[model samples]
Target: MPIVMDVDALMEFLRREFPQVSEDFVIEEVTEELTTVRLAVGERHLRPGGTVSGPTMFALADVGIYLAILARLGPVALAVTTNCSIDFLRKPASGRDLVSKTRILKLGRVLVVGDVLIYSEGDDRPVARASLTYSIPPRA
Candidate 1:
């Protein structure tokens, strides 16, 4: 399906709706088949072991999937995550950002499903993989 909201429009909507973490995420690319987002990792994102925290990675995955859905379905701010599963494969680099590549597997009228792969910036190996399901609100 064609994209209803482009990256610029999505970014603006996110910035206005989620001001807390909007700065941390940057929409790198958005296309009909895939969307890439970068997370600006800083000292605050690290855990005691000097690696990125699980919650941080999860947030990236969630946002990636949300953006992917919004790109196709337009600005649906009420759409919410109904389920998510994440597997941490490797430790993330503390000095680099995290990149998420997301693809929508299914986009139904009421539900959206997607998977995301996260890589440490500058590293080719994946640090995490996640699957997400979101509930799309009914149209008014």
Candidate 2:
């Protein structure tokens, strides 16, 4: 399906609806095939070893897919993650921002399935991979 919301619209919706995490994510690119998002990694995202934390990577994946869904479905704020399975493949580069590339695997009426690959900015290898399922609320 064609995208209903572009990057600017998605960013604005995020800022207005989810202010707490709005500043942390950058909606880099949105297309019919994929959505790219960046996490501005900071001190708080690091772990004891100075590497990016698992929870932080998971957040990137979750938010990335959420934005992807919104791009196609338009600000569907009620859409929520119903399931997520993630695998940490490698330790993320320390002090580097992380980027997630998300694509919809299946876009059904009630459920949307997506895949996300997370990498430290400028890196070729993915540090983590996630598959997520989101439940889209029925229209009123």
Where model 2 places Cα greater than 4 Å from the true spot, the runs are: none
Residue-level lDDT of model 1, residues 105-130, one tens digit each, is 99999999999999998998999999
**Scored by Cα lDDT, where does model 1 land?**
0.94
- Per model, state how many residue pairs clash: 0, 0
lDDT (Cα) of model 2: 0.96
Q: In model 1, what are the clashing residue pairs, if there are any?
A: none
**Tens-digit lDDT string for candidate 2 (10-73):** 9999999999999999999999999999999999888898999899999999999999999999
Error of 1 at 90 (Å): 0.5
Number of clashes found in candidate 2 = 0
